[model samples]
Target: MEKVRQATDSTVEMPPATGRWKLIGPGIVAAATGVGAGDLVATLIAGSRFGYALLWAAVIGCIVKIALAEGSARYHLATGSTMLDGWRSLGRWTSWYFGTYIILWGFVYGATAMSATALPLAALFPILPLWAWAMISGLACALFVALNRYEMFENVMKFFIGLMFVIVAGVALLVGPNLGEAVQGLIPSIPEGSAIYTLGLIGGVGGTITMASYGYWVNAKGWRNPAWMGIMRLDNRVAYVVTGIFVIAMLIIGAELLYTAQIALSSGDRGLLDLDAVLEQRFGPFVSKLFLVGFFATSVSSILGVWHGVSLLFADFVRNHIKGETGISREGLETTPAFRFYLFWLTIPPMILLYFGRPFLLVIIYGALGAFFMPFLAITLIWLLNSSRVPAQWRSGWLSNGLLAIAALLFIVLCINEVIGLLG
Candidate 1:
C-alpha cells in the first residue's frame, strides 16, 4: 500500500499551487543545510589554486544538486510517502546500509560541525577556548532546535541565509573580481592538476546525507500531494541557485584576492580563517570581522539544519521499519521521540571527539560510509522513481534519469577516491 500505484487518479486530478512564491520554506532550509563552511573552503581552495579556471565546475555543481533535490522531492510529492518509505520498498538491504551509515555519520559529523561553527567564534571573541566554544555551540544549537517547531527553525535559517548572502556576496563585490576572465572560466575546461578540486566542487556543493532529507523537509512544509509539484520544483531549483551564488562568491573572492597574490590557504574550515586574516590585512578589521560572522552563519545554519532535518529522517525510518506503520504517513516525524533521540545523538555524544582526537577506526568507517552515501541516494532514487513505487505520471523522465546517472557516476568516482584515501 505504501507504493504509489493506487494514487495516480487523485494525483493527476490535483490542482496547481495557487502561489508558488510563498511556498518556499523547505528549499531554503535545504540550501542552508547543504552549503556549509567546508563547502565554502573547498570552493575557495579551488579558486585559490586554479583561479577561475574551475568556475564551470562550480556552475555544473548546482545543476547536479538541482536534479538530486528535485528527484527526492518529486518522489515525496507524487507518492505522499517519505523517502524512507520508498527505500524500504526496495528491500531490507537499504535499511541495513542507512542504519549503519547515519549513526556513524552523525557521530563524526556532530563534532565536525560544532568545531566548524566554533572556529570563527573563538577567533572573534577569544574568551572561550576552542573545545569550550565547541561544547557551548553544540549545546546552544541543541537547545534552540529542541524548543522550536519547523516554522521557527525555518525562519531562523532564512535569517542566517540572508546574513550569509550579504556578507559573503558583499565581500566578493568588494574584492573586484575579474569579469572577463570569469566569463572565460564558464567554458568546461580543466586546468593542469585540478581534477580533485573539480570533482569535489561537482559532488560536494549542496550536500551528502542531507540530500536524502529533502523529502522529509518537503513533507514538513505541508506539501504532501502532487498538486504541490510545481512549487516544489521551483523551490528546489531556486535553492540551488542561491547555493550557486554562495559558492561562486567564495570562488570569486579566492580568485580575485588570493589567486593573484600567489597566496595559498590552509585546507578545511581553517582556510576560512586564513581568508579572514587576509581580509583584515587587505581591507581592514571590519571586513574581516564581517566575514567571520558569515562563516558562523554558514556553520550554525548547517548544524541546525542537520539536527532538525536528519532527525526527521531518523524518525521516519523508525516509524516505517520498527513500528510497521503502513498507513498514510503522518507529518509527525518532527515530534517523535526518535527525532529527539537522534538530535541528542547528534549534539551530545560527538563532543568527546572534539577534545580527544577522532579515533582512527571510527574516522575510517565514517569516511567510507560518508563517501558512499551520495551514490547510494542517487542510484536508489533512480530505481525508485522509475519503478512502480512512484506514480507513473511522476516517474523519472529522460532529463531526471540523465542527471541522476551522471551524478551516480561522479559520486562513484568520489567514493572510490575517498575510500582510497581512508585506506592508503
Candidate 2:
C-alpha cells in the first residue's frame, strides 16, 4: 500500500491518470449494475399506466444517479480513500452500520438477483423449475466473479449490457413510433391516477447503492487524482445518460404496446414472466423469446455486477478496517480474507434464501435499508467532498450540489414511502 499522505497533500500531488477511454471503467460497471430488472419493471409499469407522461421521471432518475455516483467517485479521487474508508472516518458506528447493512442486504439481494435471472430462463425453457435455474445462475455468477480478473470481468459486464441495450431498444422500435407524444413526455407532468407509477419511475430509474461501488472501479482503473476528476464526471454522465435512454425506451414500449391491454403484472420477479406471456400473445413466440433473452441479459448483468462489485467493496472494507491496511493490494484483493468472505457472503447464504423464498421481514428490511442508502450516500458526499478533506478543484460545484440536494430529498421521500409501504 502506498503511504496515504494527509488528505490535503494527497489531493494535490497524486499522479494524473493517462489515456481517455481507459478512465471509463468503474462508471460503466456501476451503471450496468444499477440498471436492473426492477428498474425496468418500474419503467414498464410507468409507461403502461401513464403512456409517455412519466418519461420525465426516468430522466430524473438518471440525473440523480449521476449526481450520487459522481459524488462517490469525487470522494475517492479527492481523499485517496474508498467510500468505506470515508464512512469509517465519520465514525466507527458508520462502519458498523454499513457492515451490518451490507451483510443483510447481500443475503436478500443475492436471492432476488438470482431468481430474477432465472425467471427469464424458466419462462424460455420450462423443463427445469425456477429454483433450479436460479441455483445455476448463482453458481455461474459466483464462479465468474471468483476468477478475480478485473479487466475480464469488465469486458463480460460490457457484453451483457450491450445485449440488453440492443434487444430492449430494438423492441421499442418494433413497437413503432409516436414521436409527437414521446416528445411531449419530455415535459414534466403528472397525469391523473398515475401518481404511484410516477413516483416509482422517478425513484427507481437506474438508482442503486451499488452505484457507490463505482469509486472502487475508478481506483481499479488507476485513476487517483483531481486531474482524473473531469474524465470521471464525464464518464459518469455518459453512462447514466445511456441508462436513462434505455429506461425511456422500455417505458415507450410498455406505453405504446400494453396500455389498452387488461393484463396485470405480478409483483417482483414474477412480473417479467407475466410480461413474457403478454409478449407471446401480442407478437409471437419469437418476440416472446426475444423478451426472455433481453430479460436474462438485464438480470444477469445485475447479478454479475453486484456479485463482483459489492464483493469488492466488502473485501476492501475488511482490508482497510480489520487488517489496518491500505487499499487491497493488487494480489491481495484477489485472494484475501475479506474477498473470499464476501464471496461466500454473496453466494452461499443467499442460496438458502432461494430455498426458503424471501421472508416478509427480510423483504421489509431490504427495502428499508435500500431506500435509505441513496440519501445516506448523498448526505455523506456532501459532507466529505465539501469539507477540508477535498481540494477545491476536486470538490463538487454548485450545480452538482443542487442536484445532490434534490436527490437527497427524493431519497428521503422514498425512504418514508418504503417505511409506510412496509407497515401497510
Q: Which candidate is the best by TM-score?
A: 1
Question: How does model 2 fare in lDDT?
Answer: 0.79
Question: Candidate 1: lDDT over CA atoms?
Answer: 0.87
Over all chains combined, what TM-score does candidate 1 have? 0.96
- lDDT of residue 371 for candidate 1: 90
Backbone clash tally for model 1?
A: 0
What's the TM-score of every candidate structure? 0.96, 0.93
Residue range 362-394, candidate 2, lDDT tens digits: 888887877778788888888777776666677
Q: State the lDDT of candidate 1 residue by residue for 346-414, as single tens digits.
A: 989998899898999999999998898999999998998898777789999999999999999999999
Quantify all predictions' global Cα lDDT against the true fold. Answer: 0.87, 0.79
Model 2 TM-score on a 0 to 1 scale: 0.93
RMSD of each: 2.0, 3.0
In model 1, the runs with Cα more than 4 Å from the true position are 1-18
Model 1, residue 101: what's the lDDT?
90
